[model samples]
Target: MDLDLKGSKVAVTGGSRGIGKSIATLFAAEGCDVSICARGPETIEKTRAEIESHGVKSFGTALQGRDGEAVRTWTRDTCDAFGGLDVLVCSLSAGGGTNDERYWYRSFEIDLMSATRAVEEAYPHLKSSENAAILVVSSMAAAETFVSPMAYNSMKAALITWSKQLAEQFAPKGIRVNCLEPGPTMFPGSNWEMIKVARSRTYSGVLRQQPTRRMAEAEEIARSAVFLCSPAARWVTGATLRVDGGYTKGVQF
Candidate 1:
C-alpha cells in the first residue's frame, strides 16, 4: 500500500531515540525528508545519520524540548531547510512522574506544551502544504489507568482533546490533525526499559495485562503513526486512534 509519502517533509520531536526515532526512521524509509530534535547532540547526530542512510535528506537539532523558543526556532529551521513542512509528529515527552509540583510542571511543558508550541510554529507551513498533517503522540495511559497517578498520563489526555479541537479548526485549511495513543511500547533507552530494570514488579504487572505478554515495539507504533499522518489517511482527522495492541480495555463508542 503506497502511503503516497514520498518526498514529504517531516519533523519529529524527541526523535533521537525510542518511539520518536523510530517514527523518523520509518518516514525516511518511505522516501520522506526528515528532521528531528532532542536534547542529546550525540544521539541527534546518530539518528540523523541513520535516517539519511535510507537515502532521504535528514536534519537534526539538539535542544531542550521544554524551551518554547528553541522548539519554535527548530520548527522554523526545519521548515526552511525542507522547503516546507508536510507532517509534524509531536513525540517528545517527560514520562511518568509522581505528585511533585515540579514533575507536573515538567510534564506540562515537555509533554503538552511542546506539542502545542510545535503546532503553533508549524501552522503556517502546514497550512501551505497540500498534504499537511499533525500527529500528536499520546499514550494509552491517558485512557486507562496504569501505574499510580502521574502527570504524564494527564498531559497526554490533554493532547487528545487539543488534537481533536485542532483537527476541527484546521480541516477546512487542509491540515489533518490526529492523535495516536500507544500502550507500553518498549525500546532501547525507553522509560519502560528502565522500569524493567528498576521496578520489575511494575514491568511484570504491565506485561501480564497484555495477551501477548509483551509490550509493543517502537517500530510497530511508528508504522501506525506514519499511516495516520500519510496521504493514505487523507480523510482521517479529528480522531484518536489507539495503537495499543488491545492494552486499553475501554470501548470507544
Candidate 2:
C-alpha cells in the first residue's frame, strides 16, 4: 500500500498540464519533492503551487522541450534544489498531427531528445539514490497502427526501445528504467478533448473499439505511472506497461 516514495526527489518534463502534471502532483502526494518544466510559465506556477499544496517541496521552470540546453538546465537545477534525484518521468510530448513536415522535427525534439537529454543528465544523480527509477511516457499509438503516418508514433516507439536498453544498462547501477503506454487520454484542455469536437467521427470510431467506451483520465494513468517508478515496484525494469483500459487489443508477449 505504501509506495515507499516519501522523501524522494522527482523531475517531470512537460509536466505543467495533462498527464505530466498529474504524475508530478501524485509524486508530491506520496511525499516526494517534485520539480516540473513546461512551456507555459503560468501553468508551471499553478502546477508548482498544486504540488506544494501536498506538503512537499516543489520547483518549476518554463522551457520549450525543443531546447536541449534548457532541458539539461532544468534537470540540474532540480537536483541542486532537491539534493538528489530519485525518479525521472519524461511526460512532455509534441502531440500528434500529420499536416506538415514541421511535425517531424517537433516530435523528434520534444518526444525523443527531451527524454534522452534528461536521462543522460540525471544518470549520475540517480545512481546515488537508494530507490532510483525512470518512467518514460510513451503512447499506445506507437504499438499499433491507429492514425496515418506521423512522427509522434515513431518517436514514442523509440522511447520504449531506449527505455528497455537503459534498464538493462542501469540495473547494474541500482537505477531501474521502464516505459508506460497510455491509451487515448482525455482531460480538460487535452488534445483528445479538441478531437472530440473537431473530429467527431474519428473520436467515436476510436471509442467504439474500447470495451469500456471511455477514455482514461490523467489521474487514472498517473496512478499506474507513480507505482511503476515508486519504490514499491523496485524489481520492475525493462518493461512496457500499457495503461489503456483495454483499448488496445494486441496482446503483449
Candidate 3:
C-alpha cells in the first residue's frame, strides 16, 4: 500500500547501520528524498549507496549525532541536499554499556539531547509541509525496562516525556509527532556481546517473554516508524506505539 510519502524529504539520524539503515532504506523505497547521518564514514557511505540504489535522492554524512551544534549543522546540510524536510526520524541512541558519570553524561547527550536537537532543527522545515510528521525512535525500555541498560532506560523514559510535550506544541502548527518503541531487533553489526549478556542472564525467560519467541528484524521496526510518520497516521500524535513482541504483557505476570 502507498504510504503516500512520495516527494517527502526526510532526515534520519544514526542511519549508517542497524535500525537507522533499515528506516532509511524503507523511506527511500517509498519514494522519499532521504538523508542519513552517522559517525563512521565507511558505514555512512555504504548505507547511502544502498538507499540511493532504490532510485531515491539519498545523501549520507558522518558526524557526531549527540552534539547540538553538530546536529544543527548536519540538518542544515541535509535539508539543503533534500530541498526541504517533511519527515524527521530521530533514530540516534547509545547502545548497551555503563561507565562512570562521564559516560552517563555522554549517553544523555547522544540519546536524549540529540533527538531534541534534531527535532528543533527540523521544526521549521516540518512546519512548512502540509502533512509534516516527526517520528522519534525510542525503545520499549521507556515503558518497560526489564533487563535493558540503565542509561538507556533513563534517557528513553525522558525522551517519551519530551516527545509528548513537543507533540502538543507542534500539533497546532500542522506538525504531528509520535514516538515508536521498538523491541529488540536483530540487525547486522549489532553489538552481540551485549545481547549475549542479556540472553545469558535469563535465556529461557526472556525468550518466552517474547510472544514471537524471537527478536524483531530491523525492517519490522522501520515499518512501524514509517507508518507513524506517514499521512496514514495523520491523527496519531502525542502518543507512543510499542512494537514489541508482547514482551511487555509477559513482564506483567
Candidate 4:
C-alpha cells in the first residue's frame, strides 16, 4: 500500500515520544514532511532528527500542549514551512488522574482543548489541500469503563463527539475528521510503563482483559492512525476506530 502520501505536509502534537512519535515517524516513512511539538526541547530535536532521517522534511517546536497560542503558531508555521498542510493528528494528552479539580482543568487544557485549538488553526490550511484529514488520538477509556472516574476519559469522550461533528461540518469542504481509541499501549517512558512497575496489579488487570493478554505497542496504534489519515481511507470520516487489541469489551455497533 503506497498510501499515496508522498509530499504531504503533516502535523502532530506531542510527537516527541510514545504514540505521537510513532505516528510522525510512520508518516515520514510514507514520504510526508512532518512537524511536531512537545514540551521537552531535547526530545523534540531528537524526534525531528529521526523524522528527517527518513528523507522527509521535519520541523519541531518545544512547547506545552495546553498553550493554545503556541499550538496555533506551530500550525501556521508548519503550513508556511511545508507550503501547505494535508493531515493533522492531535496526539497530545495530559494522561489520567482523579479526584482533583485541578486535574480536570489540566486534562481539559491538554487533551481536549489542544485538539480543538489545533483543528481550528489548521482548518484553513487543511481546506486548501487536495486531500485533507484530521485524526484525533483518543483512548478506549472514552468508550469503555476501564478505570475510575477521571477527567482524561471524559475529555476523550468529548473529542469523539467533536470529531464526529467536525467531520460533518468539514465534509463539504473536502476535509475528513476521525478519532482513534487506543487501549493500554505500552512504550518506553509511557504512563503505562510506569503503571506496570509501580501499580502492577492495575496493569495486570488491564492486560487480562485483552484477549491477546498483552498491551498494544505504540507502533501498532500508529499504523492504524496513519491509515485513517491517508488517502487510502478517504471515505472514512466521523468514525471512531478502536485499535485496542480487544481490550475493549463493548460491541462497537
Candidate 5:
C-alpha cells in the first residue's frame, strides 16, 4: 500500500543510530526527505549518507539532546531546509542508569525535555502540513517494571502521558501524536550490547521474561513507528503501542 509519504519532510532526533536511524531510513525509502540530529558529527554524516542512499534528501545536525535551544534550532533549520515539516520522531534517549540524583536530571533533560522542545518548535510547521504526525519513542520499561527504579523508566512514562495529551490537543489541527514503547532492543553499539557484556545477570534476567527469548531489533520497532507516523495510519493518534515481542506482560485495555 502506498503510505502517501513521498515528498514528505521528516525530522528525527537521535537519527544517527539505533531505532531513530532505522525510522528515518525507512521514511526515506518511502521517499521522504529526512533530517537527523544527533550528538556526534561523524555518525550523523555517515547515517545521513545512508539515508540519502534511499534517493531522498537528508540533513544532519550535531547537537546534544539536553540543549533545548539547540533542539529548537535544529527543528527550525530542518523545516526551513525541507520547505516544511510533516513528521517528527523524538527517539533520542539518555539510557538507563543507577538511581543516582544526577541521573534524574540527565533523564529529565534529554529524555523528556528534548521531545517537548522539538514539538513546541515544530508545532506551527506541523499545523501547516496536510499530513503531520509525531511519534514519541518511549520504552516498554515505562509500561511495566523491568529493572530497578530509575529516572529513565519514569521519564519515559511521562512521555506516554504527554503524547496522549498532545494527540487530543493537536487532533483538531490535523496533527497526529502517538507513543511507542519498545522493549529491550539490541543492536550494534546499543546500550543493551554494553550491558550484555558488563552486566550479564541483568541482561539474562530480561531475556528470561521475553517470550521469544530474544530482543527486538531496532528496525522492527521502527517499522511500527513508520506506519504510525505515515499518512497510512491517519486515524491512529492518541494510541500507545508496546512493540516488545510480548516482553511486557501487562494487558492494555
Candidate 6:
C-alpha cells in the first residue's frame, strides 16, 4: 500500500544511528527528501550517503542534540537543503549515568527538550504542507519502567504529554502529532550488555513479560512511524501508538 508520501520532505533528529537512522533510510526509500542530524560529523555524513543512495535527496549535519543553538542551525540548514519540510520525526535520546544530577539533566535536555526545539523549528514548514505530521519517538518505559534509568522514564513521560498539547495546538493547522512508544527493540546502538545485566538481576523479567517472547526489530517500529506520518493517518493525532509485542496486557495488580 502506498503511504502517499512520495515527494514529501522530512526532518529527523538523532538520525545518525540506531532507530533514527532506520527511520531516515525508510523515509528516503519512500521517495521523501530526508534530512537528519547528530553529534558525530562522520556518522552523520555516512547516514546522509546511505539515504542518498536510495535515490532521494538527503542531507545531514553534526549538531548536538542537547544544544538549542545547534538545533536551530541544523533545522535551518536542513530546510534549506530539502527546500521544504512536511514531516518532523523527533527521535532524540541521551545517556543515563549512575550520578544522579548528571543523569537527570542529560535526560531532560536530550529526550525531552531536544524534541521540543525540533518541533518548534519545523512548525512553520510543516504548516505549509498538505499532509503535515509530527511523530515523536518515545519508549514504553514512559508507561512502565523496565531496565531504563529513572531519567529515561521521566523524559519519555514528558514527551507524551508534550505531544498531546502540540496535537491540540496544531489541529487547526491540519498537522497531526503523535507518539510511537516501543518496548524492547533489537537496535544496533542499544546496550545489550546492560540489558543482559538487567535480565539477570532485575525486578521484572523482560523477555517473559512480552507476549511475543522475543525482542522487536527496528523495522517494526519504523513501519508504524511511516504509517503515522503518511496520509493514511491523517486523523491520528494526540495519540500514542504502542509498537510493543503485547507487553502491557491489562493491569497486573
Relative to the true structure, candidate 2 reaches a TM of 0.99
> Once superposed on the true structure, which residue ranges of model 3 sit more than 4 Å away at CA?
192-194, 197-199, 202-205, 250-253
Regions of candidate 6 where Cα sits further than 4 Å from its true position: 95-99, 197-204, 251-253
Q: Candidate 2, which segments miss by more than 4 Å at Cα?
A: none
On a 0 to 100 scale, what is the lDDT of residue 209 in model 1? Answer: 89
lDDT of 1 by residue, 1-253 (tens): 9999999999999999989999999999999999999999999999999999999999888999889999999999999999999999999999887878899999999999999999999999999999999999999999988798888888999999999999999999999999999989898888888999999999999999898898999999999999999999998999999988888788999
Query: What lDDT tens digits, residue by residue, belong to model 3 across residues 1-253?
Result: 6789888888999988888889999999998889998899998888888888888888777888667898888888888887788999998988756645666787799988888888878887889999899888888877765664578778888888888999999999999989988877766767543565665755556677788888888998899999889988898999888898776863432
The TM-scores, one per candidate, come to 0.99, 0.99, 0.93, 0.98, 0.99, 0.93
Cα-based lDDT at residue 151, candidate 3 = 80
Count clashing residue pairs per candidate. Answer: 0, 0, 0, 0, 0, 0
Each candidate: RMSD to true structure?
0.7, 0.8, 2.3, 0.7, 0.7, 2.4
Lowest lDDT 10-residue stretch of candidate 3: 191-200
lDDT of 2 by residue, 1-253 (tens): 9999999999999888999999999999999999999999999999999999999999999999999999999999999999999999998899998947899999999999999999999999999999999999999999999878899999999999999999999999999999999999998889889999999999999999989999999999999999999888988999999999998888888
The per-model lDDT (C-alpha) reads: 0.94, 0.94, 0.83, 0.93, 0.94, 0.84
Cα error, candidate 4, residue 60 (Å)? 0.5
Q: Candidate 4 versus the native: TM-score?
A: 0.98
Winner of 5 and 6 under lDDT: 5
The 10 consecutive residues of candidate 6 with the worst lDDT sum are 195-204
Which residue pairs collide, candidate 4?
none
The predicted structure with the larger TM-score, 2 or 3, is: 2
Supply candidate 3's per-residue lDDT for 195.
62
Which residue pairs show collisions in model 6? none
What is model 4's C-alpha RMSD? Answer: 0.7
Q: What is the C-alpha RMSD, rounded to one decimal, of candidate 2? A: 0.8
Clash pairs for candidate 1: none
